[model samples]
Each structure stands twice: as C-alpha cells, then as structure tokens.
Target: MDFEEKPFLRECKDIIEGSFGAYLNLSQQIGDLVNQHAQMVREAVSKLYSLLILTGNHSKPDTGIFMQLLKPLSESIMAIQEFREKNRASSWFNHLSAISESIGALGWVTVSPTPAPFVKEMTDAATFYTNKVLVAYKEKDKTHIDWAKAWLQFLNDLQKYIRVHHTTGLTWNSRGTPATASAGAPSAGGPPPPPPPPPADLFADPMKSGPGGDDTRSALLKELNRGTEITKGLKKITADQQTHKNPALRSSGPAPYKAPSSTSQPVVKSVAPPKPPRFELEGKKWMIEYQSGKRDLTVSDTDMSQSVNIYKCKDCLVVIKGKVNSITVDSCTKLSLVFDDIVSVVEFVNCQNIQAQSMGAVPTVNIEKTDVVEVYLNAKSLTAEIVTAKSSSVNVSVPSANGDFVEHPIPEQFKSIFNGSVFKTEPADKAA
Candidate 1:
C-alpha cells in the first residue's frame, strides 16, 4: 500500500511533460514545412511521442525506441533543404532539437539493465546527430541562424531542466526485472564470498575421522603451537625478504643478454593506437592532434579568416591568439581554449571536463556528447548563441558590469504543465 510515486517515476513523467507532448509541444510548423521527407519526419515524431505517452513517462523510456526514432528524424532533418527552401530551416532545426531533448531526457534514467552501455549508446547517438547537423549549417543567412538559435535554446532548456530536478536522482525502470536472472547464482557485482576456511586439518573431525581421536587432538594442538611460533617470529622469517627473497625470485634487469631458447615463446609486438591524432592545416581548418599536458600551447598569428580544429588533447591549455573563422574541439579531455572571437561557430564534440572562453563576438556554439563544460563569454561575446545537446554539467560565465564574471546557468530546474493551447515552460534559475 506504500505508494510514493516509485523511484524515478516522477522524473519520467517530467520528461514526458517537459518534452514534445503534454508538457511541451513539437511545434506543428516544424519539419513538415519542408516538402521533402516531411511526412516521414512527422510520422517519426508522432511515433516517438506516442511511445513516450504510452510507456516512457510512467517509467524509464526505451533507448532503442528513441534511437529508432532518431535515425529517421535525423535523416529527414538533414535533408530539409535539399530541394532549396530556407523557410524550412526553422522546422528542420526545430524537429531535430526536439529529438535531442527526447534523447537527453532518456539519458537521465536507467533505461536498460546495462546502464553504462545504455548511456554510452545514447550519448553516441546524441553526438552523431548533433554533429551531423552541421550538414545544414548556413552561416551567412540571418533567418537560418535565428532558427538555429531557437533550436539551441530549446536544447539548453532541456539540459537545465534535468539538472535542476534530477541532480542526485535517476529515473528507474518500473518494468519488471527479467525472469531470466539466475536466482541461485550470486548476483553480478555482488560482494565476494567470505575468505576460505583455515586449511583442511583445521576442520578435521577429531572424533570421527582423520586418525584416532586422541592422535588427532594432539596433532591439532601441535599445529596450533607451530602456527603461534611462526606468527611470533614473522619479522625473523621475513628478515631477508629484501636482501635474498626478492633477489632470488625476481629479476631487476635483463638476464645477462642470454639468447632466447627454442622453448621460449616469440615476443608479441604491441599494436599502435587506431586513428592516431592529427595536427595540420587542411585548406582553412587548423588541425591539432593528441597534444597532451602542455600549458603554453598557442595557435599564434591567426586571424578571423582561419579555422582551427583541436582533437583528442588531454590536460592541455591551447591559446588561439588570433581571431579565427571557427574552432572545433573534439574527443578531448581536460582541454582548455582561450581564444579571440570567431566569425562562425565554435564546436565541441564527445569531449569531457573541458572549457572554452571567447574573447570576442562569435555567432554560434555547438556542443554534443560532452559533459562538465564551462564556457566563459566576455562582454563583446555576450550575444553568442550556444547550442548544446545531451551534455551535462554545463555553465556559462559572462562579465558583470562591475568587471567580475557572473555565471548564468541555463535549463534551471522548473516545471510547466502543457496547456492545451500551447506550453509555456520557464526555468527557475535563468532570471538570475
């Protein structure tokens, strides 16, 4: 009779509400506006929403369902303008952004038995679609850019919603646990069995077996005495451990350059990493690869005409001193970027524990699959439109009038019931 809205059930409801149906609207004007694959897009959206309404919100949503929906939706969105109509940009962007929200919502819960792979696969999808959206990028057109901003705003809101509400909570799968689980076997990842009993003789039944009763008892006593003596002389017994025990058993260096005998197995060579990092200028893009643990690295003498791409760098600080056309940081860890403004977008993908600061105005910023990102926007770049999808622990700091930085977090925890006419969702912390 204990009904407290079982674990993560509310989160599921919020996700459903906050997403494209009850709590939010998949804007009717979107996707379908484009003549190409519009019906497919709508059908995919309808199917996804219907699935969410039916079972997703009552518990953890299915990752596979969302992914299946994502593929068609992504293909449709990417193809919105293939026949040429800028008006469709808004709808295309809107539909994709909506899917991003759904995907992000799905990630905040345990949808499958394997939580790690579930999150990872979902994250991969997020990154794939989000980055692939670049195929639709048209920087010179203001209207197209505006729609892009709208999409970014929606995505940012979804992220903020998750943070405010589910910081320490995860949506649980209310679905019944699999009956296939072996009840008799120790559950996976459970604690190890207790240490084995003391040797066989310690458990010998003196009266029933293992020699006559008197003899067994006497032998047990003698064994215990020997153990006690050994315990007391532990330091004496181990005294030569450093001088003889280790030297006798272990080799400190190669053994006298002896040739390998026929009995010895041939040494297997170590394999190199697949897809090693790259740093080169291909046309307009400056490629930086696998640079690690450097504090004073610089992309010097660059101007607003050049493009910079950083990949897989770790624990490093990269300073782009010159104004650049665009910058992209991908699959990197703990990387920092302090750079002048770009004429186009700044993008980050599949990265973690990373940050970037814009010293000048930038038109757009896109982030995907990355978590724990900190963005610093100075006064000149305050108007930058940031688009992040399926990312976590993200914050933007802008310079306050007093010359200090004031961090403004998007997607603050808040709630808005979907009204019949339209949904009006407001973030709780965004006003500050």
Candidate 2:
C-alpha cells in the first residue's frame, strides 16, 4: 500500500471500530443543548407576538434585532458543511484562522451575562475544534473532520443556547471519552491506542471454478506429468538396485544377506510450485469501431484447455477468458490484459463470431458516445450521448429496458459483433 492510502485505510478502520459512535454521542449532547435554547427563543418570540396582537398595534416591531442574531447561527451551519467539502489539500492552519473569524462574528450578535468568561469559553472551544480539524486536514486524516463537525454542531447549539439563556454552562459529552481523555478530544498522553490489525489471512487464496475447465485444467496436466516422471524414475532405480545386489551363497557360505540400512527408505522431498499468475480486467469488449471504412476484425475465445485470462496487477488474474461470456469493465487497476492472438486481422473483408454467456447479475456498462448503437445489453438502464445522426443512422433499443426477456434486433451494420454475446452479467464472477 502507498503511504497516503495508509491514513485512509486507518480512517476506514476507525469508523468500523468506535470513532463514529463517539461522534454520534457528542452530536446528541450538543443537539440537546441547542434544542433547549431554540425552544426558549421560540417561547419568547411567541409571548412578544401575543402582546402585540392583544394591544392591536398596527405597527410591526423591529424584528431586525432577532434577524441579526439568527443570521450568524444560519451562516455557521453553512460554513460547517463547506468546511467538510473543503479539499484535502487545503491548509488547516489557515482553516483555524477562518473559524476564529466566524466565532468572532458570532460573538458580536449576542451578549453574554458573564461576558468575559463566556467569550473565553466559546473562543476556547472554537479554537480547540478548529485546531483539531486543522491537524486532521493537514495530515489528510478524515476522522478529525467527523469529530470536528460534531464539535462544530456542539458549538452551534451552544451559541443558540447563549442566544436564550446566554449564561448556562454547555457541558461537553462525556460518553465520547477517548481511551485517554475524558472527552472525545485527544489527550496529552502518548499517541492513541493503535488500531486493531486486520486479519492475517484477509487475502487468503480462494477456491474457484473459472471459465472453461480452468479449475482442473492445469492441475490435472501438472499432476499427470509429475506422476509419469516419478513412475519412470522408480522403475529404473529398482532395476539398477536389483542388478547391483549380490546373490546369497546360502549352501556354500552359510551366510545371510541384509540390505543397507540407509537404503531401506527412499528419501524423496516434494516441493510445491510457485503460485499462479493473477489476472486483471481491461475493457472486455474492445469495440472495433469502423469510422470511415469497415474495419475487418475477428474475435475468438480460447479453447477450454488453453483459455486466455484478464489480470489485475500484472500477476493477479481478475478474469479467466473463454469462461466469461459478457464482461462489464469498470474501474480496474492495470487496465490491460495480455492476449495470445488466436487470429489478428483488421479489414472489412471478414469477421468472426465469439460465443459468450451472461451469468448472475449483468455488469453495468457505461456508454459515453451516443453515435454508436448499443448492440447487446442486459442492464435495466442504458445511457448514451447520441440521439440523432447526421449522415449515418444510430439506432438505440433497450430490449431489457422494458423489463421483458425478448431479444432486441441488431442493426445490419453491427450484427456480427452481437451474434453470440449475451447481455450484462456480474463482474466478480469474471474478475475474481
């Protein structure tokens, strides 16, 4: 794995563990505080409105004061989401500065009873949250933002509370205590406990039956070859040993002959062969398009005993050829497959038919250009770019598009490509 992927994988593991759980607990605590404050504000607003209604005052009071107060609260929410969407490349130190500014803007909108202390607490929390996020952002750590968002939410709710009570202490959630810290925030102790390691055999070899008779094909041949050699060698060794043995002169010498102690058992050591190469999937259906002239071509599946295969990394076999009929190519690593050409031709004079099948779920095919007609499909939804053609006709019909099993007609120009190929199918069956 690359160094960069380490952090992402770590973050994914953290999520699977308990980091998300802590964030949720903290979020609820913060939401409760905010909820209480909002309720109070609503009550106050209602009472004032009632008074106006009772007095029959034709004039509206300056809601400007309330609007100004609500503005920062609303803007804070937007900023939080925007911060999350911020690219991983952005500097978190600069982020801290912006968050500080937002907190200052929010401070001016409401007056705290214990103004000095309240401001200090609010600023401290904001700075802490910002710094936490910055650290995570700079390191490309994802969990910090998740925790930050929860903290930001807590702060937002705290601000709402200040708008009402303006003096009530907003206690942090205790449930989110890190292993070392009483709160979800990191502590000054040594680094957090190392995450649990993934299973040792996570990538163990899998049992499989691939396309064609790929399963027993190689093993059968190899074992047969080994058995033949072993049998021949044993026969030769036995004949030589028998000829070298001295006949016992029982009557003349009255002696008994004994075989050598070391020769009693044959010392044969068996070692396994190296693992097979891996396969990867390239664009399975290489659309042999003919733009100006017919591009004569031939496509053929390798014989069952000698089928080709698609690979992932240069060695990891992602798909076995001949066994796989219709293949859907998606985001794949090493997007190329080695092929031993059965036949190579590029002319409109001749074409070949390749029989293929669709198994399990049909893989999704993403068509970018609309000018080309869709020949064979098994997907329920098909999207393309071309709707109309200028010189040549482009036909689009979704046989499976109507939820029916009927086969669609292949245009005269493209019938050769779709002759024996089936609709969509699962990618794992082909690739794994």
- Point to the candidate with the largest TM-score: 1
Candidate 1's TM-score reads 0.42
Q: What is candidate 2's CA lDDT for residue 249?
A: 36
lDDT of each: 0.54, 0.32
RMSD per candidate (Å) reads: 17.3, 30.2
What are the runs in model 2 whose C-alpha is more than 4 Å off? 1-23, 26-61, 87-432
Return the top candidate by lDDT. 1
Tens-digit per-residue lDDT, 1-432, candidate 2 = 322133322332233234333545533454543333223322322222222121121222123322322332344334443443442122232243334334432332234344335545665545533543443344565544554565455444434444443243211123332122111212122123212222222112245332234446767878788865757655344643443364543344544677779858888799885445323222333322211111222234433223122212221222223333222222222222212212111001011111122221222222211222323333422332211212122233444545665534323232222336764432222211
lDDT of 1 by residue, 74-159 (tens): 34333332322333123243335434433433333323333334434444453443443443346443443434344344345444
Q: 413 in model 1: Cα distance from truth in Å?
A: 4.9
Q: For candidate 1, what is the lDDT?
A: 0.54
